[model samples]
Each structure stands twice: as structure tokens, then as C-alpha cells.
Target chain A: MAASVRTIAVIGFDALQLYSITELIRRENDYVILDTLDEQCDIDSIDAFIITPSEFVSRFDLFLTKRTKTLILADKVSSVGMDMSVSVVAINSRLSEIEEAISVLLNSAECGAISNSELSARERDVLKEIASGKIIKEVADTLNISVNTVLTHRKNISAKLGIRSVSGLSVYALMNGIIK
Target chain B: MTLFNINSKLCDIIFYDSSVISVINRFGINLGVGDYTVAEICRSHNLDENFLIVIINTFLNEKYFPERLLKTYSITKIVNYLEKTNSYYEQFQLPNIERHFNLLIMKSNADDGNLHLLKRFFDEMKNELLFRINFDRQEWFPQLLQLGNTTLDEDIELDNIPESAHPIEDKLNDLKSFFIIHLKGKYDVNLCQAVVSSIIALEKDLKQNNRIRERILLPFERALTE
Candidate 1:
């Protein structure tokens, strides 16, 4: 199957830098340069953002709220005083470096988006009950929830953890101290 | 999406995608392919040229699934190819990944707790993979071989067998993402890259093999059983 094209929004670069980065990005058919990010821009559609450190800092709350993959284009990594989690690439990085950063950023963003979503309190309780070797009915009884609610929680847990198997979920729970 | 044809030169095809060398190896073809076309190689190996081309094309392009062409080949041949693929994974790919993973962990800082998690995940993935290999070897392939012989084994429960490769595929992808995105601390970049690359290679191979199993093998089995 053809890979789904990833939309990238370039923000806060000079015309020359923008042209260079756009050209670099255009080299890969898998990536399309979306329109520049503005107040009216639909941030939800963007898969990633390439922005200057200043630009990222200026709209830090927006980016953080969106939790979109953002790459900071700076002269040096240490110059950016943002969270260490945010990826910083040198402004003069090679095309390969830029591509690698975007690829890794997008990949991690996908898994992070699911994993970073903390399980709801009720989901955790259901998880704890289920991970302790309780069946769905038993889990529902123990948690004082309906069987359908327990099933919903199980589905959400699997979706969040990217683990479909009960044994895998049990292992994850044990590893994370959710269960003894 | 140019499909490799019977006239496609082996050397040229290798130059196009070096990964096809492994695919060719499964067909019992080796290096020193020197100037020979696909037909010539097939003739020398006593292999069906169409079968060879279809397999290569399937590997080369994910979208190229010639179901009719695949059915033209004998089921036994397909089973043999799949058996070789399982052996390749067990004997080469799994061990290869483990070696690189070990080196990566060794080169990494001792206090990096995430590496331990990664190792645990790898072990789990490895066990799952071996279980699949064994299942195919002991059950699936044998059952396929017994096709059209007496009544089908009622206990085989072919319909109930889940998509066995999918979880392994997901875990491999997760492993790659973890290595690239989540892994931190000082470690040998080269070793880490090696581990990631090996994982990617195995993932690609598994995907291609899955295409064969899903699109070709399963359909053929269903048609015959029905």
C-alpha cells in the first residue's frame, strides 16, 4: 500500500531558509508542505511543524496544547532552552538529517500520542482488576461497573497500550507497578 | 511499480534492490549470478520461471499481488518456500537482531533502566516469534501438506487461528520506535543503528512473507477446502 502522505507546516523561517527547507522536504514524495502555520491555520491537520526556536517559544502554549510533532531549527541544540523532549535540529543540517528528524519525530509522536494519554482513573481500576486475572464479568463486579463498561475500558486500555493480548497487558501492568 | 520479469537480469535486479538477494537465496539461487536473466537462472535451478518472477515481483512491490499467477504454482512449492523463510528467520534474522541488541545494551550506560525494559520486550518478541515459527512448522505447514488427503483435520481449527504475524509485526515496529524515539543516554550510535536496521529488515521480510501467506496461501487453501 502507498504510504499516507504526511503534512508538514513550516513556521517562522526567512524566505531563503523556507525555500531551502521546502525544497529539501519536496525531495520526498511522502511529505507535503502544508501552508504556513497561522492563527487561523488548522493545526489539527498538520502531522508535524518545522519552526524556528523563537517561533516555537513564542507560541509554546499552542504547540504544547496541540502536541503536534515540532522540530526546532536552530544553529545549535543547546541554544534552545525548551523541554528536552522537544527535538532541535541545526539550521544548516543536511537533508538526510532533516529527513531523519522528521521521520523519528512523527513515529514517536504516533506512539506518544497514544501512550502519553494517561488512562482514566476508572480505566486504571478496571485494568488493575483485570490484570489480577479476573474475567470481564468478575472485573465488572469488582469495579462496580457494568459488563459493557468493563469491555469499553478493556478496549481503551488495549488501544492506549497498543497491546491487544491480555498476557501482554498483564506484563505491561506488572512492569508499570499497576499490579503485583 | 515495474515488476521484475523473466527477462530481467539477475544482476540488474540485485542492483535495483539488494534485498532481493535474500529472496533469491530462498529459491536456492546464490551469488555469482553474473549476467544471467531470471529465465536462465530458473532453468538452471529447475524452477518455474513464472513462480520465480511472481515471488520477486511480490517482494519488490507490495501492491503487486497476482492471485491467479500464484495459484498456478503447486501448493507444495509455496509451502517449501515458506518453510525456508521460517528457517531464515529462526537461523538468521532473530539471532542477528539479538546480537546487535546485546551489543547495544553493552555499549549503553549501566544505569539506563530503559535498556532493561527494551531487553525484556525483545525477549518477549523473540519468544512470540519462535512460537509462530514452531506453529507453522509443526501445525500449519503440515496441515497444508495434508490438503485433499482424507477428511481435513477437524481439530486444526484453521478458522480460529488469529493473524499470528500481526502482533509480532506490531512489537517489531514498537521496538524500532522505542529505539529511535524513546531511547536516551549515551550509547554507541552505530550499534543502535545496527539494531534498528536489522529490526527494519526483519519487519519488511515478515510483511512480504505475510503477503504471500494472506493473499496467496490462505486463499488457495480456502478454495481447495471449500
Candidate 2:
């Protein structure tokens, strides 16, 4: 039997962006967009919530319900540049990236496990460098390795951590204390 | 972390001076966890609020404090750890830059960074907090009334006491002093009437930043003596 189609809700301060993302999502899957948090919302029916940056922090406590999945989009997590706990789909994200994020969320929910334990020390070191706000080439130079080495380490790090996306890696590194 | 750990960490990464270390150490001890409020610190140390203002101004000087850690520590676990330290404000150390961070909002605007420095100074008041005062006042009032020489009466008068109009330390201290003075008094009708008005003002000012006000001020008021 085919898996049931899932519905995702896009919520944010930007109506145009919300509509666009919802349109893109609706084209590929069963989904809906909420213009605002209102009495009309069926809180029990939403499978996931994609919250924009400004809305994320203010409504974090309210929308972070146990039954619903959440994704946050922001420039930086905190003033100190510390990491945040939720996944972030960047504002200018590509379609493939968004689809991958949705798939990862579904897979993680289905598998009941998300691992960040398979990374090697070198791969972790590279991740730490990346976490400290360094670019891949810069990280490569600091580690006294080639640019290709750094990219390879990053790819390996993501796979081992059970996160196949850059945004996923960023959130993972932040929440896990692997990066500040 | 204490000035010592902060100093040691910087010394490990960059070179600094003993004079700066001494200054930071003294400042750390001054900020040590004691029964301190702005009034108490000013009275016991025989220092004017201007002196604290000067210290804060001096802290804004780039040569006096490093700008990097100042910004980073504000929104991180560093401030949390620093509060727990037995010696936080005794001495001063510089990491590298000249800047300050606003602890309350965790923002580091570059212009006159006085707001940021004052925010950290206010964070010092967190040490003595005992309980929060809110709609649940009836439940907590009995516990506190029992702990001190206070009477839990609904008719209590708070006329002479100044109401805290803001979440700033000065206002919080004023509110604390008022709470202390009214602890054992019988509710005076005339005074009770004014208190109701002040409570409304206090509630309005507190609504904007309830979490911070609750975490810092309410507990500190509870810890104050009658």
C-alpha cells in the first residue's frame, strides 16, 4: 500500500513568501498554508509547521506542541550566535532542499531515531570549524587540508549524523554542543 | 565564570596585564553573591550610584574590557555560569575588544553601549531572588508571611512605599524597600487605596517583560527583610 499523503503548514509574517512556499509544496504534496494563527486552524490536523524567523522565537512556546513537527527559519539563533534546536529551511532555499527537509522529517519520525554518533574525530573537527561560522574553504585552510578534503569531511559528517542536508547539519551541530 | 577563570582563559589565549587583573578581581568581589541590592551595595560600600555609573563607563572603554567575549557571553551559558560563581564581579579582564552587551535583551548595539552595561549590572540582582509575586500572590503570600514577620492580610496598606515603574534595578530596589516596610502593618484603608493604583501601574510596566521581571525582581523582593 502507498504511504498516506502528509500535510504541512507554512506560517510566517510574510504572506507572499508563505503563499509561494505553500504553492510550491501544494504542487508536490497534500498541504495547506495558514495566513495567520486563527480560530479557523484545525490544530489537531496539522502534520508539521514551518515557521518564519520572527514568528519562531515569539511563538516558540505556543506552537511547539508535542504532536506537531516544527521547523524554524532565522538569520541567527541568538545574539551570541549560539545554535538553535529546530531545523531551518533558509528563505532563499532551493526546491530540492525543501523537499529533502520534508523527507528527512518524515523519515526521522518513521524510524524513531536520528543519530549524530557515526562521525569521526576529523569529521567532527571540520564540523566544529563550520559551526564556528567558518566557510568550507576557510575550514580547509585551518585544518591544513585541501578544499576537497573539507567538502568530503562535510559529506561524511552529514551521512554519519543521519542528516543529509546542510541546514540539518547546522541545527544538529548547534543542538548537540558539537558547535557553540 | 569568575574574573579569575575569565582572566585565566584569556591569558591562555592572549596576553594581559596584572593591573587589569587586579581591577577585575576587585570588581568581581564587589559583585560576589551576598545580600546585595543597589541600595545595600551603595550604602555598605559608601559608594555613590555615580561610582557604579563610572565603573560601567570604564567597562565600556575598549581598553578595559574585551569586546568579543562581552558580546558572546551575554546570550550564552557564560552569564548563567558567572552568576553561580562565588566571585564574579571582583576583578576585571579584557578578551580583546572594547564593547558591551545588553543582558536583558541580549543585543549588542555599537553606539553608546551604556544600555548593555546597565543590563549586566541589573543581572547582578538575580542572586537574591526567592519567589515570584503574581496572580498567585495569595498562595505565595502565606509562605512568605510565615517565613518573616509579615501578616497576610488583604487590607494591607502600601502608601508610603514607592511602586516600581520599571524593571530597572533602581525601581526594583524601591519596590523591595516598600514591600519590606509594609510586611507587618495592618491594612490601612487610605494606604490600601493608593497601593491598588500603584499595583496597576506596576502590572502594566511588568507585562512587557514578565519573564525577566518575574525571574529577577519578584524573588529579590521575597528575599528582602521586613
Q: Cα RMSDs of all predictions? A: 15.7, 24.0
Interface RMSD (Å), every candidate? 3.8, 20.9
Clashes of each: 0, 18
Residue-level lDDT of model 1, residues A102-137, one tens digit each, is: 544454444344554666566678788887889999
Q: Could you give candidate 2's per-residue lDDT for residues B22-139 as a string of tens digits?
A: 2233433332425444334455565443333233323323234322222222222222222222132211111110112222123323343333332333233332221232222445
Best by DockQ: 1
Question: DockQ values for all predictions?
Answer: 0.07, 0.02
Overlapping backbone residue pairs in candidate 2 total 18
What TM-score quantifies how close candidate 1 is to the native fold? 0.60
Q: Please report the TM-score between candidate 2 and the true structure.
A: 0.26
| Reference interface contacts recovered per candidate | 0.00, 0.00
Candidate 1 wrong stretches, greater than 4 Å: A1-180, B148-165, B222-226
Q: Pick the lDDT winner.
A: 1
* Model 2, docking class: incorrect
